[model samples]
Target: MSRKTDPLIVRRLRGEERVLEVGIGDRTGVAARLVDAGIDVRATDVRPVAAPEGVRFRVEDVTAVDEPDAFHRVDTVYALNCPAELHRPIRDLAAAVGATFRFTTLGYEAPSIPVERETLGGGDTPRLTLYTATTRDGTPRGSR
Candidate 1:
């Protein structure tokens, strides 16, 4: 994805609030882009990885996260191209922290969390599809 598109996607997922990028692999490009755009964001994964300057990094396994405050600091949680198996855990984590969840799945795979669909870009621009999970009250977070 282009650097310009990265921030747009983050904004679409998180609006202007702090976001936690879960399952961030070796690449911190998205996190870096968000930081450059003046958004408060962090990246995490099951294994340790180096983050770009101004971006925070943490080692977290969503499937086994037991910390009560695991995601309390962020307003939204998201992962790009997240695996199908991690969707439920991510949703639970978001709920635990009272934050919203968002993710993009590989290909045509659907998200495990109930979501509202959004499409970014048009015509000449590459279109990206994202799923934004709702709170238990059924309000779409970040849409506000």
Candidate 2:
């Protein structure tokens, strides 16, 4: 099967030292593509999977990585799942790791039937949100 996840992991990796993927899933296809494109990559998640060639696998909780300074050595970070309140934490992690580019694809919130209206900010509208952040700061400090 053709894997659609490869593009997200490879696009911004041209001149980076290495790229890290937060969720590996069945998306080894992306890892394979990254290797083919000459981008060094590491894959990490709570679960373990045999990684494809040229992709290093790390089994650790994103929130529990002890050495936050290690992140400053990478060029890119990818997070596909939208983990609610932890979004900012992930962004901080990417920054800590020295990732100049970060990309995330969050699941679209289910559309509401009536669509609640807001008196302020803006009127009721369909919302699609994806979380992506890039920063020169490669460390988790203060707030994102």
Best-fitting candidate, scored by TM-score: 1
lDDT of residue 58 for candidate 2? 82
Best by lDDT: 1
Candidate 1, residues 1-144: lDDT per residue as tens digits?
Answer: 444457557567545568889988875777877787787887788998887888777887888887747444688888888888898888877777777777888775777767888888777767877778875576775443
Local accuracy of candidate 2 as per-residue lDDT tens digits, 1-144: 123433533553555657787767666776677788888878887888888988888886777765765533576676555444445556667656555334443454321111121121113432323234522352322222
Per-model RMSD to reference: 2.7, 9.1
Clashing pairs in 2: 71-97, 71-98, 72-97, 72-98, 95-138, 95-139, 96-138, 96-139
Q: Report how far off residue 40 is in candidate 2 (Å).
A: 1.0
User: Lowest summed-lDDT stretch of 10 residues in model 2?
Assistant: 113-122
Error of 2 at 16 (Å): 2.3
The true-versus-predicted C-alpha distance at residue 112 of model 1, in Å, is 1.9
